[model samples]
Target: MTSILIADPIPLLNKGEQALLEGIVESLNIIFSKPDIMLLSNYPEKDARRSRIPVINRNPVLFKSIKKIMPRSAFLLEGALMAILARFGKQNFRRLFTRSELWQAFLNSDIIVVGHDSSVSYDAVIIGWLLNKPLVIFAGSIELFRNKLKESIAKVLLKKVNLITLREDDSYKALMDLGVIPGVKTQVTADAAFLLKPCSPERVKEITQQEDLPVHDRPKVGVTLTRQMCERSHQEINDVNERYKKAIAEKAIVLDEIIERYNVEIVFFPHCIGPGKNDDRLVARDVIQLMKRKDMVKPVVSDLGASELKGLIGQQCEVFIGERTHSVIAAMSQGIPSICITFPSDRRTHGIIGGMICQRDFIYNVERLNPIELLTLVDKLWAERPVIRKKLEGIIPLVKERALNSARLIQTIVSEKEKSDNGYRCPSSQH
Candidate 1:
């Protein structure tokens, strides 16, 4: 069995992250027949094992100690401190690298697959180098974090990765700006979740039945809203509460108008569910409370797997409007009309993905948002649903094909390594 270690993914919290993990596992299974795959997770062993997948708890001793003494409300501060340790300092960095469990996991893996959501950590890259193992970074955005020290360390460490696959144009440009690593093979591909198969007809039927979702004779819209648009844990905004109130009020108004004008029923889909402050379930309820016509909206809080939820959206909704990128991705993958409400700071990932799949006009920047403009676009989209669906039907398949290219690349790299180690040469042309 080819052992692969997946790093830097919290598979149990956000559904988008869950989908990315599932999609990569599916691809690896297809490529290696029987690969032994493990994940580095911040979640506890018992909780992480609930997925029935092998997981290594990645919280180092320092992190555990921090959590033990720190109050729950200071979680974000704890994260900032951890980030500093990971990037700024030498002592904590050595402590992380010297951890026996981390080194053991790194040494055991035949190949390391850094996840599809963010860049790999410097420690992970260093471990890969120390072991001389080939690493493939799967699809995701890649930009330097706010820490310049981290950026410098990452630039040096990333050079050792065998292949780095980027999922969107913005990340490609960001990588170019970061300067090319001499030996790393870089490729652009669609997000792996694009190829995620939908839930079975039976599963869809079960979900709708359980939720008592209206299937026909009425227009239905799926909406995903998160606290990400309104607040950040560490950042200070002028009158943050007032900003949230304004945004929430605007969203509620939009929802009400859409229902009033189009006679559409709205279902709020919670994309990220957990105990965290940014839990989508909490934000969904907050939005509902702020709405004038709360009766028109219902929050679906099921614990369905990622693909299953995507299937529900495909089967049940006429259109999807999401603040979360993956919810929009799910809708687009299934040929449903989708709109992404983006934050102004997100100049890359959101716009690039939506522009590539849907038209550029479908991407909305929240900072410059106009309620009337959005309502007009919604009405237009509804009017032209057939044409949009047809376009999506043509686009999604090609994107899926591109997604599979990442899997093919990993297979080729692994196969060549096995042959060379066994004293057999791969044909010169194959190189």
Candidate 2:
């Protein structure tokens, strides 16, 4: 059996990352008969249960542990310290690649698929080198580096991957601008989550029953906002504490207006349920508190798996407005109209993805995040839901095909490696 290990899946906390892992695994299962798969995550039990794969819990490296101990305000300082340490030599870098669980899983696997949804930090590339294995940067996006020192480190590590497939044109350009090495098999593909099929109807019924979610007669609007993005905006903008306050407060007002005009029920989907600031449930509730019609807004904070959450969104929501890329993806894949709200420095993932289905009608930057403008956009999108759904119906399948191609590319790469090891074709070829 071919053993494949997925690194940095982070399935439990963030639903978008979960969708990517599941989409890839689903493709793998179709091509390979019962391949051995292992996932690495911080929340092993939750991830394993959700993905239906054995998982190894990855421990934080010394630097990461130290960084975590510091207050969030010092994140920039921690990043600088890490960059300085990384520039010192490979010894500092190798210290991060020596986790026991990560090493054990890498040794047991034939191929490594690194998630690109997060930043390209080069940890997986280093681990791949230690095991002398080929690795792929799965369907994800990367930012164009503004810092030269970090860019140097990123370029060196990114080039080591066996294959690099990015989700959008902007990310592809970012990789090129960062200087990808020649002869590295690189291509542009849609995000793996774009291929995500909803959960079974039976499972959907089970979830709705267990959660006791109301079956609203009016249109249901699904919403998700990430606390991380809001906090990051706080750091980036000037006198923005008031602006951030207004953004959330204004969001509530917009929703109220939307409810009044369209008679829609708002359902808040908290994709990240991790500890501390990562808990989106808190943000969802806070937004509800700011709303005028609190009775019309409901928060779904249950520990639902990614597909189940997507299934719920697909089944109940007439339209979605989410800061989380995956929540919007879940909505769009099911032909639900969506509006993706992105902040500054967002690698253009939201704009590119939303444009594929709804043109620019559904993509909004958070810079102009105000009640009046948002209400206008929401009204326009709700009015255009039929046309938007029609566009999504045509686009989603093509995106899925592109996502599955990543898996096929992996098979071809592994097959060629085995062929070169022996004079004849590999024995596994017939399967």
Clashing pairs in 2: none
The residue-by-residue lDDT of candidate 2 on 1-431, one tens digit each, is: 88788865565667777777778788888777789888877677767777677888664343466556764423334333333333343654534433345554554566778656755536665655544567888776777667989889888878778888777777777777777845578887677777667889889888878777768588799999876555544344576466557567777778888889988888888887876777788888878898889988888879777888999998889999888888888988888888888764665555356444545667777765666777788888888889888988898888888878788888887797676632111122322
Candidate 1 off by > 4 Å: 45-52, 60-104, 145-147, 232-237, 422-431
**Ten-residue segment with the worst summed lDDT in candidate 1?**
422-431
Candidate 2, lDDT over the whole model: 0.72
Candidate 2 weakest ten by summed lDDT: 422-431
Q: Could you tell me the lDDT of residue 56 within candidate 2? A: 80
User: What C-alpha lDDT, on a 0 to 100 scale, does residue 178 get in candidate 2?
Assistant: 72
Alpha-carbon deviation at 201 in model 2, angstroms: 2.2
Clashes of 2: 0
Q: Rate the local accuracy (lDDT) of all candidates.
A: 0.72, 0.72
Which residue runs does candidate 2 get wrong by more than 4 Å?
9-11, 60-102, 229-241, 422-431
